[model samples]
Target: MTDDARELADDVQELAEAQRQHWQNTYTTHPGMYGEKPSSPAVHAALVFRAAGAKDVLELGAGHGRDSLYFAREGFTAQATDFRPVGLKQLRRAAQEQGVAARLSTVVHDVRDPLSLPDASVDAAFAHMLLCMALSTKDVQALAAEVRRVLRPGGTLVYTVRHTGDAHYGAGTAHGDDIYEHGGFAVHFFPRHLVDSLADGWTLNQVHAFEEGDLPRRLWGVTQSLPQ
Candidate 1:
């Protein structure tokens, strides 16, 4: 690789490791920080999945299993994955306490890597504010492809991402590729075109704008489905 390309790769690697460590520390310091209640997106996703006759749900970036646990309680077998083990540990504890351990499972996974799931194994997938993390445009595209690969034909995917219109879109240190670091957390604010491009091979269902959290992070709730 050229010197510039090598530097960019190194920067990406460093940022990813730093974010992982930050998440670990954050989760350890504030266990169940996001509370036990599922996000609104998850609630909406459950309804969509149920309407589509989905039985199994794969959740990416399932911090502390709030949504995954909710899914299990709602009668869908849920598999939750996150890059941080601390969060998953809390998730497992909560799952057992909630009596959903039998229907819930956890995996420590980073979205930058290929998902370790069999092809067409899941009926639905959900991700809230995950695709907006410190990922490059290419990484997000690859992750979307992986999600598509692991979902059954006609399977549904419901994901949410903070878009460029958010208040913190250009705040803090820029990491290029629309990624910016704010208070140690990196985010890749999505542009409209990128979202449209990712749905190229899929049936674009809906893109609804919404806000969450105290900051009221502006996001788009996107739903797509593979061809049957």
Candidate 2:
């Protein structure tokens, strides 16, 4: 690689490590910070998964697993992954408490790396606000490919991302590639074209706009399916 390319790769690695530490500390301090209720996108994804006849669900960035537990409760075997082990521990505790331990599993995973799952293993995948993390455009695209690799043919993917129209889109420490860090949290606000690019080779189903949280973050709930 060229010198500049090497520097950028190093920077991305440093940033990813920093963010992982930040998340670990955050979950350690806050514990179940997002509460037990599933996000609106997750609820919608469950319905879509059921309609697609998906018996198993893979959830990325499933911190504390609110949605994972919900899916287990709804009768789908759920595999939840997050970079933070603390968060996954909390998710495990919650799953046991909710009597869905057998139906739910947790893995500590970083989305930047390839998924540990086997090819065509999962029936559905869901990722709420994960693709919009501190990932570069390349990293996000790689993650999309990994999701596709794990999902069965005709498998569905429902994901949510904070878009360029959000209030915080450009209001932070710019890391280039549309990524910005604010209050020690980095986000890669998605542009419309990025969304369209990610959907290439897949059947784009819907792009529904929605808002959430006290800041009322604006996001798009995207659904797509692989060709059978």
Candidate 3:
């Protein structure tokens, strides 16, 4: 690459790192950001697991454990991990309050770093709205690898991510950049091609793009059953 291109790439990386730090600070200051209850996607994902006979599930970037709580309520053994300490604390409290202690475990983990789970340790893995906001292509790829590493062979990966062509860009999101600053932090956006590219080794069983009402949000999901 030319020196000019390299310089621009460095600038973008620095901006993305700033944005990531901002989000970490936000969750640290306000654990309630994930909401008092889980969202519809979380509930829907939980039901899918129950029907699939998946008893052991691991959720990556389990902010505040909203979906984890839902999974626990449904009698699934759910383990969730996030990088933020405050969010995990709130999640633990919420689980105890919701009577899901028997089915839930929370771990402090950063997917960008090395993962500590043994291979094929989980029956299924879920990533909800976590694919976006990656700092770079490498971070995006690492997130996928982490999910693949933790799942049992033939395990299911249920992922929901924001669509790149959705109308929400530039209003509160960065546009034309690999990553953008939002609410004091940087967020990465992935076009469909990039999302699929991250799934390089995983068997792509299905890919669906859906929108609800006038929410101006699009979800691009891929369902993959891990290879044996």
Q: Give a tens-digit lDDT track for model 3, residues 1-228.
A: 999667766876666556556667888887777676666666767766676678898988888888888888878899988877677888899989988887899899866676778987888888787766644576677767877887887778887776666655455655335555455544455587886786677778778887644665677766777676
Winner by lDDT between candidate 3 and candidate 2: 2
> What are the runs in model 3 whose C-alpha is more than 4 Å off?
1-17, 170-177, 212-215
Which 10 consecutive positions of candidate 1 have the poorest summed lDDT? 4-13
Instruction: State the weakest 10-residue window (summed lDDT) of model 3.
Output: 173-182
Q: Which stretches of candidate 2 lie over 4 Å from their true place?
A: 1-3
Q: How many pairs of residues collide in each model?
A: 0, 0, 2
How well is each residue in 1-228 modelled by candidate 1, as lDDT tens digits? 999777766787789889999989999999999998899999999999999999999999999889999999999999999999999999999888889999999999999999999999999999999999888887899999999999999999999999999999999998878889998999999999999999999999999999888897999999999999
Q: After superposition, how far is residue 180 of candidate 2 from its true place, in Å?
A: 0.6
Q: Enumerate residue pairs that collide in model 1.
A: none
Quick one: how many clashes does candidate 3 have? 2
Q: State residue 153's C-alpha deviation in candidate 1, in Å.
A: 0.4
lDDT of 2: 0.93
Model 2: per-residue Cα lDDT over 112-178, one tens digit each: 9999999999999999999998888889999999999999999999999999999998987877778
